[model samples]
Target: MNGPTILLVDEPTSALDHERGAAIIELITALTHERATATILVTHDRTHLTAADQIVEIHDGRLHLPAPAC
Candidate 1:
């Protein structure tokens, strides 16, 4: 039962050491693209953030989009 899928991972890399964390993030990203699945990776690491196609930040219970440059 699979065509396209979605993965909602919360703090998925937080527990691992640096190398393992990076590896895990890479694995997740690879699987998402390879399987054509939509992945919502919830992480505080800015390094992993770049791997996302789009990013939504939340603060004080509010969602924030990137602000327009002046």
Candidate 2:
């Protein structure tokens, strides 16, 4: 794979089924870790965000970040 410092993915799994979507997420996660690449995943589906290191949401043209875990 080409060495990239960052990867931006937009709705990569939107057209896929649940299983395929999961596989894509896993692949992205693995690549992010293995390559030490920063990944930006934009998706409407909130089901698979567990793989993210940080999660943010945009609402009413505002950016909202979640509170850190206790």
- State the C-alpha lDDT per candidate: 0.86, 0.94
Per-prediction CA RMSD (Å): 2.1, 1.5
On the 0 to 100 scale, the lDDT of residue 35 in model 1 is 92
Q: What is the lDDT of residue 28 in candidate 2?
A: 98
lDDT of 1 by residue, 3-41 (tens): 758888999888888899889989989999999899988
- Score candidate 2 by lDDT: 0.94
TM-score of 2: 0.91
Candidate 1 weakest ten by summed lDDT: 1-10
Per TM-score, the best of the predicted structures is 2
**Top lDDT hit:** 2
